[model samples]
Each structure stands twice: as C-alpha cells, then as structure tokens.
Target: MNIKQYLDSTYLKTAFQTGISETENEIVVKNAIKEAIDEGFKLIMIRSEYVALAREMILQANSNLNVGTVIDFPEGKSSLETKVKEANEAIANGADDLDFVCNYEAFKNGDTELVKQEVLVATQIGLANNKTVKWIIEVAALSDKEIIQLSSLIKNIVISNFKEEDYASVFVKSSTGFYKTDDNSPNGVTIPAIIMMLENASPLPVKAAGGVKSYEEAIEMIRLGVKRIGTSSAKAIANGGNIPNQY
Candidate 1:
C-alpha cells in the first residue's frame, strides 16, 4: 500500500502543552511541514496558527500537500460560535481541510441539540469554503453506545443538510489524540471503536487518528474502511517504522 498517501502528517503541540517556548513549537511545526513536502504525505495537519505559514511553505515547494487544521481541538467544550469562528479564520488562512472536535460530552450529557448544532454549523462553514471537514469524536471518553450515537448523529446531520454529492467531504473521525483517561491508558483509536464508527457513520468516510503507530497498523485501519489516518508518526509509518509517542 502507498501508506504515505493515506497519512495526515500531524504536529499539534502548543507551547504550553509541550512546556517549550513558542519558537521551539514553531520548529516542530516547520519540521513536520518540511517532511510532508519532501516525503509527499497526504496532508500536513497543524495548529491553526501555522496554517498561513504552512500554506506559504507548501506553495514555495510547489507541492500539492494539503494543509489541515484543528478546530476546538483536543477540547470540544468551546461554544459553537467559537468553533465556527476558528474554522472560518483557518480557511481564510489557507487550510484545505478542517478536523473539528465534536462536543461529545454535551451529547453524552443529553444535550444532543447542542452537539448537533455545533457540528451543523462547523460542517456548513467547511462545505461553504470547499474544504473537507472531519468531526473528531473522542472515542476513548465515550461508551460504545455513545460512539454509535455520535457517529450516526454526524452522518444524519450531513445527509439532512447537504446535497447527496457533498457527502464525501464530511467525515466522522475517531479521536483527538489528547483526551485524558483515568488509568492513563492509551486513549487512541481502537479497532472495535473504529468498527462502530464505520458501521454507524456509513456513507461518510471515517478517519482513524491518535495511536496509529506503524505502517502495518495504518494498513489495517484502511482495510477496515478508514479513509484517513492521522498521526505524528506518519513519516515513520511510511518508512515502515514506528514512533514511541502517541501524538
């Protein structure tokens, strides 16, 4: 398999999250962007602040590598307006695709309308801008039933609100790679969780993110019907190696 083509080469660490200075964080982002260009990965997924820079770099290199950004990223607790605004700004800055963290907590709390509203508005913004939009439903934080519900929720919203031809642009992604677990367990995408997502979010593509560690694992995800694989280890995976860190 051409695993690099399925990879969304990712670097989403903030300065505060890494305990590094802003300059150090920029280096990490720049390195990922360079690798994506040199290696011909599918997309370079970065924090929104660097979308413009990544765009400029990709243009300079004359590569068709896409620039994707996260919205309401690791945390999905932001207000709907905040998420939509973030998405708009990222698109204007040259983001080709957007991965949004769905407000899974709200849906689990019985606030289904709020969850639906957030996704509806965000998906609209992306579709309007002719960009791909993937909703990150942190599977580790949800029960099996919640995964089914949220995955179907996103699919249903798109089907109801968008034309049939636009279905391919929306995806139900598996994780944000940053949710906390009580036992400090690996909270990344799991086979069972992805199966649930695929079955429930039918017709809409699924992206397996988080702990996809190697080329073999990525192949497994694609075989199971995942259309995208999000990982910081994309270069390693493409090289048939593995990285130790989850992100």
Candidate 2:
C-alpha cells in the first residue's frame, strides 16, 4: 500500500515537554515540516502556533501538502466559545484541517447535550470554511461502551444535521496522543478501540492516532478501515522501519 498518503506526519510537543528551549523546539518543528514536504506525506500536523510557519514553508516549496493543527489540544474540557475561537484562529493562520479534542469528559458525566452542541458548532465552522474537521474522542480516557457511544454520537450528529456530500469532510478520530493513564497502559489506538470506532462512526471516516508507531501497525489500521493514521514516526514508518515510544 502507498502508506504516505494515509499518514498525517505529526509533531505537537512544546518546548517544556521536550526539555528544550523554545527556539530549539521551533527548530524541531521546522525540521518536521521540511521532512513532511520532502517525504510527500498527506498532511503535517502541528500545534496551532506553527500553522503560519507550515503554511509559508508549503507555499515556498510549491507543495500540495496540507497543514493540520489541533484545537483545545489534549484536554477537551474547554468551553464551546473557546473551541470555536481557537478553530477560527487556526483557519485564519492557514490550517487545512482542524482536529478538535471532543468533550469526552462531559459525555461521561451524562452531559450529552453539551457534547452534541460542541460537535455541531465546531463542525459547522470547519465546513463553512471548506476545511476538514476531526473530533478526537481520546479513547484512552473512555471505556469500551463509551468509545462506541461517543463514536455513534458524532456520527449521528453529522448524519442528522449535515448534507450527505459534507459527511466526508468530518471525521471521528481516535485519540489526541497526549493523554496519560494512571497505570501506564496503552493510551492510544488499539485494535479493539478502532474496531468499535469504525463500526459506529461509519458514513463518517475514522482516523487512528496515538501509539501507532510502525509501518506494520499503520497498515493494519488502514486494513481495518481507518482512513488516516497520525504519528510522530512518519519518516521511519515511510521507510518501513519500526520506531517505538512515540505518539
């Protein structure tokens, strides 16, 4: 399979997280952008602060690579207004895809209306801007039943409110790649989790993120019917090598 097309080459670490200075961290981001361009990956997923940089680089190279940025990253507890504002800023800065962390906590707390409202509004902003929108459900933070329920929740929202042609523009993504579990478990996409998402989120595409580190694992996800795979090890995976311990 042509794996590069399915890969969203990602780097979302901050200076503090990487134990490096801000300047050094930016250098890392720049290198990642360059690598994505040279490798012809589908998209480059970075923090919103670097959206402008990725846009300028892609423009300079005259490449077709799209720029993707996260909104309300890692934590999905932000208010609806805050999420919309963040998504708008990312779009203005030239982001082609907006990956929003869904309010999974609220869903778990039995606040379905809040979750539905955010999905509807955030998706409207993205579709109106002619951008692809993804909802990161953070499967690591949920149980099996929650995963299926939340995936179906997103699917129902899109199907009920959006046009048929617009369905492809919205996706129910698996994780944020930054959630930590207390017992150090796999806090990312697992086969079971992905299966649940694919079955319930259908008609809307699914993206498998987090803990997908190797070419083999990526292929498996794609074969299991995920349309996209987000990983920090895109370069190694593209080269058919296995690199572990990355988001």
Candidate 3:
C-alpha cells in the first residue's frame, strides 16, 4: 500500500519532558532519522531545534525524505510574530513542511480575527519559503460545528490570499495530539472529525494526526481522503503493530 510514503515518522519531545539529557534526546532523534531512511518514510517530523540536525542526517544518508517541524506546537496561543519567527528559523534550518498549531481557542471565543491573522501570517511564511504548511486545528478539543467552521476558515483564507496553484501547498490538519478533555478523554483525529474537515475543506487537503496507531487506522484515514498521517508509530504501522500513543 506504500504506507511508508503516507507516514510522517515523528519524534517531538523536550529533554526535560522525556527526562533524558539533551545529548540523549539527539541520539533518539538520530535513531528516528536513521529508521526513517531505512524504512523509506516520506518525512521525518521533529521539533524545530532539531531540524538542521535531521536535515543533515537525511542528506548524509542520501535519502529523499522531507524534514518537518511544528510551530507554536501543542499550544496555539503564541502571537503571530512569534509563530512567523519560529517558521522562518525552521525554514532556515531546512524544514520542508511545517505543521502549525492554529488559534482555535481564540476562534471558539469569537475572536475570529485573531485566528485568521495567525493562520495568514504562518501561511504566508511557508508559501514564501516554497514549503508545505499544515494547519493543526486540535480536533479533539472542538465540537463538530467548530471543526467544520475552522476547516472552512483555513480554506477560505488560503483561497482568498494565495494563488490557485499554491492551494496544494496548504493543508488543514486535524490535531496537535496534546489536547485532553476535562475527563481526560483521548485527543486526536477521529473518523467523524476528519469527515467534517474533508467535506468542509475541499481541495485544500488534510492531514490526520494522533491516535493513528495501527495500519488499519492509517489505511482507513487515507481511504477517507487524508493526504498525510502523523504518528510516532509509523514503523509499527508499517509492520502491522501498535506503539504507545504519541502526539
């Protein structure tokens, strides 16, 4: 099924959180890069601080993999200027795809302008750099109505501000994988949420992230029109196994 091509083999963790030293974290990152190269995944998504290192490793291996990073990460509350600067640095570090955490909290609060501005600025930066950009809406934290609305918002903004051909460079993605409900419910892409996004954000493409732990789920997500699958278990999925949940 060329499943590896659909995967964005990921490793995004701070040394503090993982309780590993910075050098240990890099070792882990390097292992992921090597695994990606050996397994032929389409991309390796890591934090921005490691973009250059990942890029160099991929280049050294003579692999055709893309380097990706997250911006504003698990929280979408960063100011527009900060997101832009982060994106710029990632680009300079050789990131080919950027998954940006959208300001859904603001949108839910009726501050649509803030959401739009944040998206517009990030999109502009990615497009100007000739890179692919994905807007992570953090679906597990939203209602069905909000999913449709936010997906539509991203589509509308990109369509109005960018050229038609550039539409392919933009994607409305499903989650940050870090969101949790008050009751500690699982957070990430669900079938219904992705269906809403696909229906509302037509022609803009979608990336399903989080909770995709097996080949079966990944295949189903692709069947439902997802262009990318973000998961730490890419290798496991490729081998028909499951790994612990990662965001």
Candidate 4:
C-alpha cells in the first residue's frame, strides 16, 4: 500500500480508550471502555494497573483488539529504575504497548544523559521481555532548545534500542500537558516535529497522541508519519459527532 493508504489504515485505527480511576470517576472508566469496545473500537488504552483486567475483558469479547497501557504515566517523578521495572511488569501482565512519559525535569535541566538513561532502561526492559515501549515526549513542557535537545537524545536512544532490538513505538506527546513544570499551555503531538522525528528515526516510527479529537486532526497526524494515536474523542469522529461525550 502507498503511504497515504497506510496512513488511512492506521488513523484512528480504533478509538483510543482512556481511563480515570474509579475514585477519579465515580462512574468508572472501565465500564466506559467496555461500552466503547462493543461499539467497534479495536484499540484501547487503560492504566497499567488494569492491564490484566482489560486483557480478560477483551478476550471474553472474542474480538480482535489491542490493549495499551502507560509507563511513568502523567508523572515522571518516579525513579528511572522504577519506571523501567514498571514497564517490564506491565508487559508481563499483558500490556500490548507502552506509552511512557520521560523525566521532564531532567530533559528541561539539560540532563541529556539522564534522559537517555531513563529511556534506555525502559527500552531495555521492553526488549528483554518482547514488549513494546513508546517514549512520550510531552511536547508542551520544553523550550525550543529542550525540544531539539531531547529529540536528538531520543534519536540516539532509538538507535541504541534498535541495535539491541529493544525498539517499540516512539511518540511525541503533548499532555500529561503535564505537571512539574509551571507551563500549562494546551499542547499536542505537533505535526511538524512528528514528521521531523520520523524523518530522522526512519523505521523506528512514532505515535502521535493527545488533543486528537477529529477525523481531520487525526488524518493530519497520520500524514505527518504517525502510525498510531491516543484520543478520548473517538465517538465524536466515528459517528460524525453524533454521540457527544458528556464531559
């Protein structure tokens, strides 16, 4: 297939499934995912803790679906070593893909070595266990220097990971739009950087996530070389905006 065809095939490949802890959502996001999957979404993302439960649910549905979970999640405050272990553990339990958040403070402080180390550890864990790892470069938190710096670091890290065959999908993400830095601009996996990263990384590929809420935006990300997406705006796209989320 041509690049355009490949792009269309993967775009919104399925509505991305999201999670909010039951405590965070008295309505429980798991139930929402179940309903979403039934509605014909084949790709879903949930908390690392719920990996096994999600696996069981998907298996019982007897449908072709891939389940994704996070590592280091919305926070990069956890120790790098801990993040790697969490990645390994999540995969062992049944995570089809890992969307990992990098240590933002380290990247922001110009600690390239630390950033590489964190990514290295997690990628090693993923490779060791045949798991997939994706680096979520929260694009919103960086200065232009930080972005360019971390991008090189990720390139190096991906090279290292590839040499060892520890490769997973790498993503330039926009949110956790996250905390820890005082910046709170609504960010996303920008089309330009996504293209640049793919042009540089070649076969390693990238996943564009966050703020992806429509068929138009999703297609743009795909056009920019993203092989995957993360969005809560699934129903909006699938039904021509018919089933609006009540959030």
For this target, which candidate reaches the highest lDDT against the unseen true structure?
A: 2
Give the alpha carbon lDDT tens digit for every residue of 54-154 in model 1: 99999999999999999998878999999989999999999999999988889889999999888888899899999999999999999999999999999
lDDT tens digits by residue: candidate 2, 76-115: 9999999999999999999999999999999999999999
Off by over 4 Å in 3: none
Clash count (model 2, backbone only): 0
Clashing pairs for model 3 are: none
Compared with the true structure, the alpha-carbon lDDT of candidate 4 equals 0.61
Please give the CA lDDT of all the candidate structures: 0.92, 0.96, 0.90, 0.61
Error of 2 at 98 (Å): 0.2
Summed backbone clashes in each candidate are 0, 0, 0, 0
Clashes of 4: 0
Q: What TM-score goes with each of the models?
A: 0.98, 0.99, 0.97, 0.78
Off by over 4 Å in 4: 1-27, 39-42, 164-174, 177-184, 242-247
- The best-first sequence of candidates by TM-score reads 2, 1, 3, 4
